[model samples]
Target: MHGEFWQLDNKNPDAKLYYKDHCIDYNELEAQVQQAVNSLPSERCLIALVAQSTLDFVIFYLAALRQSHVVLLIDAALAENDRNELLEHYQVNLLIEGNKIHSLSDYTHQLADELCLLLSTSGSTGSPKLVKLSKANLVANCSSINQFLPIIKDDVVMTFLPLSYSFGLSILHTHLAMGANIVLQSDSPMSADFWHNFEHYKVTSFYGVPLSYQLLNRLGLEKMPLGNVRYMAQAGGKLLARDWQLLSDYTHNNNIDFFVMYGQTEATARIAYLPAEYFSRQIGFIGKEIPGVELQLLDSEGERVEQFDSQGELCVRGSNIFGGYSETLVELSYFENIPLLHTGDIAIQSPSGLYQIVGRSKRICKIAGRRINLDELQSWLDALCQFEVVCVGSEDEIVVYSEQPIEAEVIKQLATKLKCHSRLIQTIVLEAIPRLSNSKVDYHALKQ
Candidate 1:
């Protein structure tokens, strides 16, 4: 009754995990993980994971890795066809689903050089890039992040997002490293059980995307019984001025730390985070480099720019960076200490020694004769009405699309708001915009 992160501690018999009705000791979960691992065919195992952040998912994931099997993490929100295609393309010989793993303690192991985990990424070119990260990558990154964030043993964490995303993965790794408690709920965030679970479990921390905070602000969290969350971190995307303004005030008044983190899947989840103490004044900043990491900014000539408040392409060098991608035919390429990961993001170093993500270089377009950053424009649109607007370009003109098309009056209003010439911009309304497998808007596909 033991494996992976936590060994079975039947001797202690005192460690407990909370459930609505009863508490489960560490022995039960440890036994479950070991049994699951023993039952599976461990050699070269490539399987799809579909657990909903429940105790079952956590147990199965740890068990699979404990025995050194390759696992593919898929978001539950992914269309079934895309999920199937991902597995099929990799020619994964076995598949694992459901909360229950058929109990068996019989399995084989022959992996001293085989791959362990295949993580899919949306490459800069708008295609799926599969990176093969070993147990080493996951374990190392987890340990490093834990050093900076003093996550106490069994500290309560509320996980409201999908586990497949890299940001979510970091939460899993760090928690497991400290044997922390995760309060899992399978309902929508708006449900009564959602907040009740946090309060009941006595959650102290949580992570969210920018949209999550924006939505919470719109819903007005003044009356929500969140109990006491000691910290709330934001990642996945940028939080604009409107949401940041209210969130900063709320967290400050509540005496809670608000962490603003930034990273990519390439870095195994996170590379930087802003300490909660620095907020309100410079809301978009993503703070300093995470522990065991260094950052630099380079232009087209690949020279470092050292001046404060200067903009350039951001680069990161860190141990958390994942190893190279796995090939379909089979050949392993390991990652070394690469000096830079040229993030396509445009960033600026502030006077007070902080980093702020201004916009993505890929999203900038020339509207008429002037260069306009789409992300910057979108921020203006959000302030006006919280509308999600994406701007793309043609050879000579720029096209802006939104779910609810803005009226002629709205366009004029936006022009006044953004200080842009009205005639040069074209606005259209569409029922939907196509996104990639990873849920990022497919600007390249939109190119005609």
Candidate 2:
């Protein structure tokens, strides 16, 4: 049997999808999906879907999955060269770009029946390394997320994040699974048009990365009209403790739920989430693992870490864990059962069983015989400067970037804090921090 990841057919027919001023109910959406499905080749093929946050994207995505086609969701803003290179390398049989669908290849490559979706690991670079996920992975994650978030039929959500990104895709999956209304738009959250639609439709929920929340906070979130907003979720990266507290206070005072989530693309979307009730107590902790997901901290020796407040690489085991990585046609023909996903993130578990990410295992650098965690340093710098800061480093030195100019004294103080020479630390001021379309910091762009 072909696995239907999203059971759109079973959803309430009256649930609406708002795009511009037009609204389509779930029954009409199902009909459109069927029409799109009928147009595609019946054989299982790798389809490259240029995912934009629009009604067409949603309809086509659901249609492709319903037909049991392997879909490679691509960012709509991906560079043409990068996009073409990926399409060729993967031997994609079909290309769905906007309202048009093109037959790219006639050769049908054999694919595992269970393999359903392929997503790029990085949003900025359009990395060819794709995470392979099956229908079970998507359904497990959606159910896990739904178990925690209080979504209802009347709830309205705005789709601002690209549907290609895992975190963004999860929002679409969980919302649609609940038969809730979704407002599809490609407009930036900074735009007046976005806020206009948000207020007009009475959008109840939205998700953002750390950078999005930081920008919103800067725009004076308290001053904005948020009467309909029931909750705000943050993921994609760690929101600084200071920023987390600021948001927690705002959400608490405003009677809105604030969820601090943690996950990677490999886990299909979310691994753990800080419940809104615990937000005030746990400022920087990623509270607990989502339902049906188990998390463990493993040391370099691959042994489970038992001590509280000790750092270890975070590991996840769940039905939601991706099948494997696929960079070639042969890799897609067979499913690799990866029962445990090593997240590459260093985390610490508190005595109360809450987990907080400290840094990435690869984000560490040594200078002057001392090891430094770039994430820790960045957090320190952010708190010190009271602004957004990004830290990247080599073996000899750490370079910090900030949108606002930092005083020389601050650099000197940071060096003193790290017990390193002032020359080893350098600061650069940029008009803005480089970010991906998903609003996560683009370290690749910054390094360039």
* Candidates' C-alpha lDDT: 0.68, 0.87
Which ten residues in a row are the worst by lDDT in model 2? 1-10
Candidate 1, run of 10 with poorest lDDT = 103-112
Runs of candidate 2 exceeding 4 Å displacement: 1-5
Report the C-alpha lDDT of model 1 over 1-448, residue by residue, as the tens digit: 1112433443234434554464566677788888887876746555667645677677778777777666777666666776667656656555566564432223332323535676656522312457666666566567666765657665777776667767776786676656667666655456678877877777888677766675678678677665577778888878767788898888888887788888887777787888777875677889888878888988768889899888899998876666666544343334344446787998999878799888888877765456778777777776675667777764465577877867787788866654667876788777876655334566766654
Structural RMSD, model 2: 1.8
Best by lDDT: 2
TM-score of 2: 0.97
**What C-alpha RMSD separates each model from the true structure?**
4.5, 1.8
lDDT of 1 at 133: 67
